[model samples]
Target: MVDDTLLETRHLTKEFAGFVAVNDVSLRVRRGTIHALIGPNGAGKTTVFNLLTRFLPATHGQILYRGEDITHARPAEVARRGLVRSFQISAVFPNLTVLENVRVALQRKLGTSFHFWQSERSLDALDERATELLAQVDLASHRELLAVELPYGRKRALELATTLALEPELLLLDEPTQGMGHEDVGRVTALIQRVARDRTVLMVEHNLSVVADLSHVITVLARGSVLAEGPYADISRDRQVLEAYIGSAEPEAAV
Candidate 1:
Protein backbone atom coordinates (compact mmCIF):
# COMPACT_ATOMS: atom_id res chain seq x y z
CA MET A 1 0.00 0.00 0.00
CA VAL A 2 1.20 3.54 -0.77
CA ASP A 3 1.91 5.59 2.34
CA ASP A 4 -0.47 8.47 2.86
CA THR A 5 1.90 10.67 4.82
CA LEU A 6 4.42 12.76 2.93
CA LEU A 7 6.49 13.40 6.04
CA GLU A 8 6.41 12.03 9.59
CA THR A 9 8.66 12.08 12.60
CA ARG A 10 8.81 9.76 15.59
CA HIS A 11 10.10 11.12 18.90
CA LEU A 12 12.27 13.59 17.02
CA THR A 13 14.80 15.19 19.33
CA LYS A 14 17.80 17.48 18.95
CA GLU A 15 20.24 18.37 21.71
CA PHE A 16 23.15 20.75 22.07
CA ALA A 17 25.73 20.04 24.75
CA GLY A 18 23.17 18.22 26.97
CA PHE A 19 20.61 20.97 26.42
CA VAL A 20 17.58 19.66 24.59
CA ALA A 21 16.78 22.26 21.95
CA VAL A 22 14.01 20.14 20.53
CA ASN A 23 12.53 17.48 22.80
CA ASP A 24 10.87 14.44 21.37
CA VAL A 25 8.76 16.38 18.91
CA SER A 26 6.68 14.19 16.64
CA LEU A 27 4.83 15.66 13.66
CA ARG A 28 2.89 14.45 10.63
CA VAL A 29 2.48 16.52 7.49
CA ARG A 30 -0.02 15.37 4.94
CA ARG A 31 0.71 15.53 1.27
CA GLY A 32 -0.22 18.82 -0.46
CA THR A 33 -0.94 20.92 2.63
CA ILE A 34 0.43 24.12 4.07
CA HIS A 35 1.54 23.56 7.67
CA ALA A 36 2.79 26.38 9.83
CA LEU A 37 4.94 26.14 12.95
CA ILE A 38 4.64 29.19 15.20
CA GLY A 39 6.44 30.24 18.38
CA PRO A 40 8.28 33.10 20.03
CA ASN A 41 12.03 33.69 19.82
CA GLY A 42 14.38 30.88 20.84
CA ALA A 43 11.52 28.38 20.86
CA GLY A 44 13.52 25.83 18.83
CA LYS A 45 11.74 26.55 15.54
CA THR A 46 14.97 26.84 13.54
CA THR A 47 16.43 23.86 15.39
CA VAL A 48 13.56 21.74 14.14
CA PHE A 49 14.30 22.82 10.57
CA ASN A 50 17.98 22.04 11.04
CA LEU A 51 17.24 18.59 12.32
CA LEU A 52 14.68 17.80 9.62
CA THR A 53 16.93 18.97 6.80
CA ARG A 54 19.93 17.18 8.35
CA PHE A 55 21.93 20.35 8.80
CA LEU A 56 22.39 19.11 12.35
CA PRO A 57 22.42 15.45 13.32
CA ALA A 58 19.47 14.38 15.43
CA THR A 59 20.43 13.58 18.99
CA HIS A 60 17.82 10.78 18.78
CA GLY A 61 14.66 9.62 17.01
CA GLN A 62 13.62 9.08 13.40
CA ILE A 63 12.60 11.17 10.40
CA LEU A 64 10.64 9.40 7.75
CA TYR A 65 9.81 10.66 4.29
CA ARG A 66 7.27 8.67 2.36
CA GLY A 67 7.47 5.88 4.98
CA GLU A 68 11.25 5.51 4.64
CA ASP A 69 13.68 6.45 7.40
CA ILE A 70 15.92 9.44 6.55
CA THR A 71 17.14 10.59 9.93
CA HIS A 72 20.81 10.66 9.02
CA ALA A 73 20.68 11.51 5.31
CA ARG A 74 23.04 14.23 4.15
CA PRO A 75 21.56 17.58 3.23
CA ALA A 76 21.97 17.12 -0.53
CA GLU A 77 20.61 13.59 -0.26
CA VAL A 78 17.54 14.88 1.52
CA ALA A 79 17.07 17.60 -1.08
CA ARG A 80 17.47 15.09 -3.87
CA ARG A 81 14.54 13.22 -2.37
CA GLY A 82 12.36 16.27 -3.13
CA LEU A 83 12.59 18.11 0.23
CA VAL A 84 14.12 21.60 -0.05
CA ARG A 85 14.40 24.53 2.34
CA SER A 86 14.51 28.31 1.96
CA PHE A 87 16.56 29.93 4.66
CA GLN A 88 15.30 32.76 6.89
CA ILE A 89 18.03 34.91 5.50
CA SER A 90 17.88 35.54 1.76
CA ALA A 91 20.09 33.21 -0.34
CA VAL A 92 20.91 34.71 -3.67
CA PHE A 93 23.89 35.54 -5.83
CA PRO A 94 24.15 39.26 -5.22
CA ASN A 95 26.46 39.97 -8.09
CA LEU A 96 24.50 37.88 -10.59
CA THR A 97 21.57 39.37 -12.43
CA VAL A 98 18.16 38.23 -11.24
CA LEU A 99 17.71 36.11 -14.34
CA GLU A 100 21.19 34.67 -13.97
CA ASN A 101 20.53 33.65 -10.36
CA VAL A 102 17.46 31.67 -11.32
CA ARG A 103 19.07 30.31 -14.47
CA VAL A 104 21.86 28.84 -12.40
CA ALA A 105 19.32 27.18 -10.11
CA LEU A 106 17.47 25.77 -13.10
CA GLN A 107 20.71 24.42 -14.50
CA ARG A 108 21.31 22.54 -11.28
CA LYS A 109 17.91 20.90 -11.53
CA LEU A 110 18.43 19.95 -15.19
CA GLY A 111 21.65 18.05 -14.44
CA THR A 112 23.75 20.49 -16.46
CA SER A 113 25.17 22.32 -13.43
CA PHE A 114 28.63 20.94 -14.13
CA HIS A 115 28.75 22.60 -17.53
CA PHE A 116 30.29 25.77 -16.13
CA TRP A 117 32.33 26.45 -19.27
CA GLN A 118 29.35 26.22 -21.64
CA SER A 119 27.57 29.45 -22.49
CA GLU A 120 24.27 29.86 -20.62
CA ARG A 121 22.49 30.33 -23.95
CA SER A 122 23.38 26.74 -24.87
CA LEU A 123 20.94 25.52 -22.22
CA ASP A 124 17.77 26.73 -23.87
CA ALA A 125 15.52 24.53 -21.79
CA LEU A 126 17.01 25.73 -18.50
CA ASP A 127 16.71 29.36 -19.59
CA GLU A 128 13.08 28.85 -20.54
CA ARG A 129 12.29 27.17 -17.24
CA ALA A 130 14.03 29.88 -15.25
CA THR A 131 12.13 32.57 -17.13
CA GLU A 132 8.85 30.89 -16.31
CA LEU A 133 9.75 30.79 -12.60
CA LEU A 134 10.75 34.44 -12.66
CA ALA A 135 7.34 35.27 -14.07
CA GLN A 136 5.61 33.19 -11.43
CA VAL A 137 7.26 35.20 -8.65
CA ASP A 138 6.51 38.48 -10.49
CA LEU A 139 10.20 39.13 -10.83
CA ALA A 140 10.23 38.91 -14.60
CA SER A 141 10.20 42.71 -14.82
CA HIS A 142 13.46 42.80 -12.86
CA ARG A 143 15.13 40.02 -14.81
CA GLU A 144 18.13 41.98 -15.98
CA LEU A 145 18.66 43.85 -12.71
CA LEU A 146 21.37 42.80 -10.30
CA ALA A 147 19.84 40.66 -7.51
CA VAL A 148 21.39 42.98 -4.91
CA GLU A 149 19.93 46.02 -6.68
CA LEU A 150 16.32 44.89 -6.43
CA PRO A 151 14.27 46.07 -3.45
CA TYR A 152 14.33 43.89 -0.33
CA GLY A 153 10.91 42.39 -1.00
CA ARG A 154 11.78 41.53 -4.58
CA LYS A 155 14.92 39.84 -3.33
CA ARG A 156 12.75 37.48 -1.32
CA ALA A 157 10.71 36.76 -4.40
CA LEU A 158 13.90 35.98 -6.28
CA GLU A 159 14.83 33.49 -3.57
CA LEU A 160 11.45 31.83 -3.92
CA ALA A 161 11.91 31.56 -7.63
CA THR A 162 15.30 29.99 -7.15
CA THR A 163 13.84 27.40 -4.78
CA LEU A 164 11.12 26.63 -7.29
CA ALA A 165 13.79 25.83 -9.84
CA LEU A 166 14.60 22.76 -7.76
CA GLU A 167 11.13 21.26 -8.40
CA PRO A 168 10.58 20.15 -4.81
CA GLU A 169 7.62 18.15 -3.59
CA LEU A 170 7.95 19.69 -0.12
CA LEU A 171 9.06 23.27 0.34
CA LEU A 172 10.36 24.36 3.74
CA LEU A 173 10.13 28.10 4.20
CA ASP A 174 11.91 29.73 7.13
CA GLU A 175 10.20 33.06 7.72
CA PRO A 176 9.51 33.80 4.03
CA THR A 177 8.04 37.18 4.87
CA GLN A 178 10.44 38.31 7.56
CA GLY A 179 11.74 41.90 7.33
CA MET A 180 9.11 43.10 4.94
CA GLY A 181 6.81 46.10 4.85
CA HIS A 182 3.03 45.62 5.00
CA GLU A 183 2.65 45.77 1.23
CA ASP A 184 5.55 43.40 0.72
CA VAL A 185 4.18 40.99 3.31
CA GLY A 186 0.86 40.89 1.51
CA ARG A 187 2.59 40.17 -1.77
CA VAL A 188 4.64 37.34 -0.27
CA THR A 189 1.55 35.91 1.43
CA ALA A 190 -0.27 35.78 -1.87
CA LEU A 191 2.75 34.24 -3.55
CA ILE A 192 2.92 31.54 -0.89
CA GLN A 193 -0.77 30.72 -1.31
CA ARG A 194 -0.22 30.42 -5.03
CA VAL A 195 2.75 28.11 -4.57
CA ALA A 196 0.83 25.97 -2.04
CA ARG A 197 -1.66 25.13 -4.73
CA ASP A 198 0.76 22.51 -6.05
CA ARG A 199 3.34 21.77 -3.32
CA THR A 200 3.34 21.07 0.41
CA VAL A 201 4.80 23.92 2.43
CA LEU A 202 6.10 23.65 5.99
CA MET A 203 7.04 26.99 7.45
CA VAL A 204 8.21 28.51 10.72
CA GLU A 205 6.54 31.87 10.84
CA HIS A 206 6.43 34.45 13.65
CA ASN A 207 3.96 36.78 11.99
CA LEU A 208 0.58 35.93 13.57
CA SER A 209 -1.48 37.41 10.76
CA VAL A 210 0.48 35.49 8.14
CA VAL A 211 0.02 32.29 10.12
CA ALA A 212 -3.72 32.88 10.48
CA ASP A 213 -4.09 33.76 6.83
CA LEU A 214 -1.93 31.07 5.25
CA SER A 215 -1.80 28.00 7.48
CA HIS A 216 -4.19 25.08 7.12
CA VAL A 217 -2.72 23.59 10.29
CA ILE A 218 -0.79 25.36 13.00
CA THR A 219 1.64 23.80 15.48
CA VAL A 220 2.65 25.87 18.48
CA LEU A 221 6.02 25.30 20.09
CA ALA A 222 7.10 26.63 23.47
CA ARG A 223 10.21 25.80 25.50
CA GLY A 224 11.25 23.03 23.11
CA SER A 225 7.93 21.18 23.01
CA VAL A 226 4.53 21.32 21.34
CA LEU A 227 2.11 23.52 23.28
CA ALA A 228 -0.72 23.01 20.82
CA GLU A 229 -1.49 21.59 17.39
CA GLY A 230 -4.72 21.91 15.44
CA PRO A 231 -6.60 23.98 12.92
CA TYR A 232 -6.23 27.75 13.32
CA ALA A 233 -9.46 28.22 15.29
CA ASP A 234 -8.76 25.41 17.71
CA ILE A 235 -5.18 26.39 18.48
CA SER A 236 -5.96 30.10 18.62
CA ARG A 237 -8.47 29.63 21.44
CA ASP A 238 -6.44 27.05 23.36
CA ARG A 239 -6.00 28.37 26.91
CA GLN A 240 -2.66 26.67 27.42
CA VAL A 241 -1.42 28.06 24.16
CA LEU A 242 -2.64 31.56 25.06
CA GLU A 243 -1.07 31.61 28.49
CA ALA A 244 2.19 30.00 27.51
CA TYR A 245 2.77 31.74 24.21
CA ILE A 246 0.19 34.48 23.62
CA GLY A 247 0.11 35.89 27.16
CA SER A 248 -2.93 36.33 29.43
CA ALA A 249 -4.94 39.50 29.44
CA GLU A 250 -4.90 41.75 32.52
CA PRO A 251 -8.21 42.96 33.97
CA GLU A 252 -9.22 46.42 32.77
CA ALA A 253 -10.04 49.12 35.33
CA ALA A 254 -13.72 50.08 35.68
CA VAL A 255 -14.63 53.11 33.61
Candidate 2:
Protein backbone atom coordinates (compact mmCIF):
# COMPACT_ATOMS: atom_id res chain seq x y z
CA MET A 1 0.00 0.00 0.00
CA VAL A 2 1.17 3.54 -0.71
CA ASP A 3 1.81 5.82 2.25
CA ASP A 4 -0.94 8.11 0.98
CA THR A 5 -3.58 5.40 0.95
CA LEU A 6 -5.52 4.91 4.18
CA LEU A 7 -7.39 1.81 3.02
CA GLU A 8 -7.31 -0.77 0.24
CA THR A 9 -9.35 -3.78 -0.70
CA ARG A 10 -7.78 -6.39 -2.93
CA HIS A 11 -10.03 -8.68 -4.94
CA LEU A 12 -12.69 -8.24 -2.33
CA THR A 13 -15.51 -10.68 -2.87
CA LYS A 14 -18.55 -11.79 -0.94
CA GLU A 15 -20.90 -14.67 -1.68
CA PHE A 16 -24.23 -15.67 -0.20
CA ALA A 17 -25.16 -19.21 -1.11
CA GLY A 18 -24.48 -19.01 -4.85
CA PHE A 19 -24.95 -15.30 -5.31
CA VAL A 20 -21.94 -13.05 -5.71
CA ALA A 21 -22.70 -9.75 -4.05
CA VAL A 22 -19.32 -8.09 -4.45
CA ASN A 23 -17.00 -9.62 -6.97
CA ASP A 24 -13.27 -9.09 -7.13
CA VAL A 25 -13.46 -5.44 -6.18
CA SER A 26 -10.30 -3.48 -5.48
CA LEU A 27 -10.59 -0.07 -3.89
CA ARG A 28 -8.14 2.50 -2.61
CA VAL A 29 -9.15 5.29 -0.29
CA ARG A 30 -6.59 8.09 -0.12
CA ARG A 31 -5.62 9.48 3.23
CA GLY A 32 -7.62 12.43 4.52
CA THR A 33 -10.00 12.52 1.56
CA ILE A 34 -13.71 11.81 1.18
CA HIS A 35 -14.53 8.98 -1.24
CA ALA A 36 -18.02 7.94 -2.18
CA LEU A 37 -19.54 4.68 -3.37
CA ILE A 38 -22.67 5.40 -5.43
CA GLY A 39 -24.87 3.06 -7.41
CA PRO A 40 -28.49 2.27 -7.95
CA ASN A 41 -30.08 0.16 -5.23
CA GLY A 42 -28.84 -3.49 -5.07
CA ALA A 43 -25.50 -2.64 -6.58
CA GLY A 44 -23.87 -4.17 -3.50
CA LYS A 45 -22.92 -0.84 -1.92
CA THR A 46 -24.04 -1.83 1.55
CA THR A 47 -22.60 -5.30 1.09
CA VAL A 48 -19.23 -3.71 0.47
CA PHE A 49 -19.67 -1.75 3.69
CA ASN A 50 -20.54 -4.92 5.53
CA LEU A 51 -17.42 -6.62 4.23
CA LEU A 52 -15.17 -3.69 5.15
CA THR A 53 -16.47 -3.42 8.72
CA ARG A 54 -16.60 -7.18 9.10
CA PHE A 55 -20.34 -7.18 9.77
CA LEU A 56 -20.28 -9.94 7.19
CA PRO A 57 -17.25 -12.02 6.37
CA ALA A 58 -15.90 -11.84 2.87
CA THR A 59 -15.99 -15.02 0.87
CA HIS A 60 -12.57 -14.13 -0.49
CA GLY A 61 -10.03 -11.28 -0.74
CA GLN A 62 -8.16 -9.10 1.72
CA ILE A 63 -8.86 -5.83 3.52
CA LEU A 64 -5.88 -3.67 4.31
CA TYR A 65 -5.87 -0.70 6.66
CA ARG A 66 -2.84 1.52 7.07
CA GLY A 67 -0.79 -1.13 5.22
CA GLU A 68 -1.82 -3.88 7.60
CA ASP A 69 -3.99 -6.71 6.32
CA ILE A 70 -7.08 -7.05 8.48
CA THR A 71 -9.16 -9.36 6.35
CA HIS A 72 -10.14 -11.49 9.32
CA ALA A 73 -10.35 -8.87 12.03
CA ARG A 74 -13.54 -8.86 14.00
CA PRO A 75 -15.82 -5.85 13.98
CA ALA A 76 -14.80 -4.73 17.47
CA GLU A 77 -11.17 -5.22 16.54
CA VAL A 78 -11.57 -3.11 13.42
CA ALA A 79 -13.29 -0.38 15.45
CA ARG A 80 -10.52 -0.56 18.03
CA ARG A 81 -7.99 0.00 15.27
CA GLY A 82 -9.77 3.23 14.27
CA LEU A 83 -12.04 2.14 11.41
CA VAL A 84 -15.62 2.83 12.48
CA ARG A 85 -18.95 2.52 10.71
CA SER A 86 -22.09 4.56 11.24
CA PHE A 87 -25.20 2.44 10.77
CA GLN A 88 -28.10 3.36 8.47
CA ILE A 89 -30.12 4.50 11.46
CA SER A 90 -28.70 6.79 14.10
CA ALA A 91 -27.10 4.66 16.82
CA VAL A 92 -27.74 6.95 19.74
CA PHE A 93 -29.26 5.54 22.93
CA PRO A 94 -32.71 7.04 22.97
CA ASN A 95 -33.05 7.15 26.74
CA LEU A 96 -29.70 8.81 27.37
CA THR A 97 -29.10 12.50 27.18
CA VAL A 98 -27.11 13.55 24.10
CA LEU A 99 -24.17 14.41 26.32
CA GLU A 100 -24.24 11.05 28.02
CA ASN A 101 -24.31 9.16 24.71
CA VAL A 102 -21.09 10.80 23.61
CA ARG A 103 -19.56 10.40 27.03
CA VAL A 104 -20.21 6.69 27.03
CA ALA A 105 -18.63 6.27 23.61
CA LEU A 106 -15.58 8.20 24.76
CA GLN A 107 -15.28 5.95 27.78
CA ARG A 108 -15.49 2.89 25.55
CA LYS A 109 -12.77 4.28 23.32
CA LEU A 110 -10.57 4.84 26.32
CA GLY A 111 -11.10 1.24 27.41
CA THR A 112 -12.61 2.33 30.68
CA SER A 113 -14.54 -0.46 32.32
CA PHE A 114 -18.10 0.17 33.27
CA HIS A 115 -18.35 0.45 36.99
CA PHE A 116 -21.79 1.10 38.38
CA TRP A 117 -20.17 1.88 41.72
CA GLN A 118 -17.59 4.29 40.34
CA SER A 119 -17.71 7.87 41.50
CA GLU A 120 -19.58 10.36 39.34
CA ARG A 121 -16.43 12.47 39.20
CA SER A 122 -14.68 9.96 36.89
CA LEU A 123 -17.45 10.34 34.33
CA ASP A 124 -17.48 14.09 34.79
CA ALA A 125 -13.94 14.15 33.46
CA LEU A 126 -15.34 13.08 30.11
CA ASP A 127 -17.71 16.07 29.80
CA GLU A 128 -15.08 18.39 28.36
CA ARG A 129 -14.13 16.02 25.56
CA ALA A 130 -17.74 15.04 24.94
CA THR A 131 -18.73 18.67 24.68
CA GLU A 132 -15.98 19.24 22.15
CA LEU A 133 -17.28 16.34 20.03
CA LEU A 134 -20.87 17.59 20.26
CA ALA A 135 -19.66 20.99 19.13
CA GLN A 136 -17.92 19.37 16.17
CA VAL A 137 -21.28 18.04 14.97
CA ASP A 138 -23.22 21.21 15.90
CA LEU A 139 -25.06 19.45 18.69
CA ALA A 140 -23.68 21.42 21.61
CA SER A 141 -26.93 23.33 21.96
CA HIS A 142 -28.88 20.10 22.37
CA ARG A 143 -26.47 18.45 24.79
CA GLU A 144 -29.05 18.34 27.56
CA LEU A 145 -31.86 16.89 25.47
CA LEU A 146 -32.55 13.19 25.51
CA ALA A 147 -31.35 11.51 22.34
CA VAL A 148 -34.92 10.36 21.64
CA GLU A 149 -36.20 13.92 21.66
CA LEU A 150 -33.92 15.25 18.94
CA PRO A 151 -35.43 15.86 15.54
CA TYR A 152 -34.30 13.44 12.82
CA GLY A 153 -31.51 15.69 11.65
CA ARG A 154 -30.37 16.49 15.17
CA LYS A 155 -30.41 12.81 16.08
CA ARG A 156 -28.17 12.07 13.12
CA ALA A 157 -25.89 14.85 14.32
CA LEU A 158 -25.78 13.21 17.72
CA GLU A 159 -24.89 9.91 16.07
CA LEU A 160 -22.04 11.58 14.24
CA ALA A 161 -20.87 13.02 17.55
CA THR A 162 -20.74 9.58 19.09
CA THR A 163 -18.92 8.20 16.04
CA LEU A 164 -16.38 11.02 16.28
CA ALA A 165 -15.85 10.23 19.94
CA LEU A 166 -14.10 7.07 18.75
CA GLU A 167 -11.50 9.24 17.00
CA PRO A 168 -11.53 7.00 13.94
CA GLU A 169 -8.82 7.43 11.35
CA LEU A 170 -11.20 5.98 8.74
CA LEU A 171 -14.97 6.44 8.91
CA LEU A 172 -17.63 4.59 6.93
CA LEU A 173 -21.01 6.24 6.66
CA ASP A 174 -24.05 4.43 5.24
CA GLU A 175 -26.64 6.72 3.66
CA PRO A 176 -25.98 9.75 5.84
CA THR A 177 -28.69 11.79 4.15
CA GLN A 178 -31.31 9.10 3.72
CA GLY A 179 -34.78 10.09 4.91
CA MET A 180 -33.63 13.65 5.65
CA GLY A 181 -35.43 16.79 4.53
CA HIS A 182 -33.65 19.12 2.13
CA GLU A 183 -32.61 21.46 4.93
CA ASP A 184 -31.35 18.60 7.05
CA VAL A 185 -29.55 17.08 4.09
CA GLY A 186 -27.66 20.31 3.53
CA ARG A 187 -26.75 20.54 7.17
CA VAL A 188 -25.46 16.96 7.38
CA THR A 189 -23.61 17.43 4.13
CA ALA A 190 -21.79 20.39 5.59
CA LEU A 191 -21.15 18.50 8.80
CA ILE A 192 -19.65 15.57 6.86
CA GLN A 193 -17.39 17.90 4.98
CA ARG A 194 -16.20 19.50 8.19
CA VAL A 195 -15.44 16.27 10.02
CA ALA A 196 -13.72 14.68 7.02
CA ARG A 197 -11.09 17.40 6.78
CA ASP A 198 -8.66 15.42 8.96
CA ARG A 199 -9.76 11.84 8.27
CA THR A 200 -10.57 9.48 5.43
CA VAL A 201 -14.31 9.05 4.84
CA LEU A 202 -15.84 6.36 2.62
CA MET A 203 -19.57 6.78 2.31
CA VAL A 204 -22.49 5.20 0.44
CA GLU A 205 -24.92 7.97 -0.35
CA HIS A 206 -27.98 7.85 -2.61
CA ASN A 207 -28.06 11.64 -2.96
CA LEU A 208 -25.90 12.38 -5.95
CA SER A 209 -25.75 16.08 -5.20
CA VAL A 210 -24.23 15.47 -1.80
CA VAL A 211 -21.86 12.90 -3.28
CA ALA A 212 -20.81 15.23 -6.07
CA ASP A 213 -20.32 18.13 -3.69
CA LEU A 214 -18.33 16.25 -1.06
CA SER A 215 -16.51 13.47 -2.87
CA HIS A 216 -12.92 13.89 -3.93
CA VAL A 217 -13.39 10.60 -5.77
CA ILE A 218 -16.45 8.62 -6.73
CA THR A 219 -16.76 4.95 -7.63
CA VAL A 220 -19.89 3.79 -9.40
CA LEU A 221 -20.92 0.19 -8.95
CA ALA A 222 -23.34 -1.75 -11.08
CA ARG A 223 -24.41 -5.35 -10.73
CA GLY A 224 -21.79 -6.06 -8.04
CA SER A 225 -18.95 -4.58 -10.08
CA VAL A 226 -17.30 -1.22 -10.48
CA LEU A 227 -18.78 0.44 -13.53
CA ALA A 228 -16.82 3.65 -13.34
CA GLU A 229 -14.31 5.35 -11.05
CA GLY A 230 -13.05 8.91 -11.12
CA PRO A 231 -13.83 12.43 -9.99
CA TYR A 232 -17.53 13.27 -9.71
CA ALA A 233 -17.46 15.25 -12.96
CA ASP A 234 -15.99 12.44 -15.01
CA ILE A 235 -18.04 9.63 -13.51
CA SER A 236 -21.15 11.73 -13.97
CA ARG A 237 -20.52 11.77 -17.72
CA ASP A 238 -19.79 8.08 -18.09
CA ARG A 239 -22.40 6.55 -20.39
CA GLN A 240 -22.32 3.27 -18.47
CA VAL A 241 -23.24 5.08 -15.27
CA LEU A 242 -26.26 6.76 -16.85
CA GLU A 243 -27.53 3.52 -18.34
CA ALA A 244 -27.25 1.67 -15.06
CA TYR A 245 -29.87 3.97 -13.56
CA ILE A 246 -32.05 4.04 -16.64
CA GLY A 247 -35.41 2.69 -15.49
CA SER A 248 -35.19 3.93 -11.92
CA ALA A 249 -34.87 7.41 -10.46
CA GLU A 250 -31.71 8.53 -12.19
CA PRO A 251 -28.62 8.90 -10.01
CA GLU A 252 -28.57 12.63 -10.83
CA ALA A 253 -25.15 11.82 -12.17
CA ALA A 254 -24.81 15.15 -13.93
CA VAL A 255 -24.53 16.91 -10.61
* Tens-place lDDT digits, model 2, residues 96-123: 9999999989888556757768786889
Kindly provide the TM-score of model 2 when superposed on the true structure, using C-alpha atoms: 0.96
Candidate 1 lDDT score relative to the true structure:
0.87
Clashing pairs in 2: none
What TM-score do all the candidates reach, one by one? 0.94, 0.96
List, residue by residue over 1-255, the lDDT tens digit for candidate 1: 765589898898888889989998999998888999877677799999999999999988999998889998999999999999999999999999999999888877568889889875787666677889999999888899999998999999999999998999999999998889999999999999998899999999877788889988888887788878999889878887777654423111000
Model 1 stretches with alpha carbons more than 4 Å out: 1-3, 246-255
The most accurate candidate by TM-score is: 2
Lowest lDDT 10-residue stretch of candidate 2: 246-255
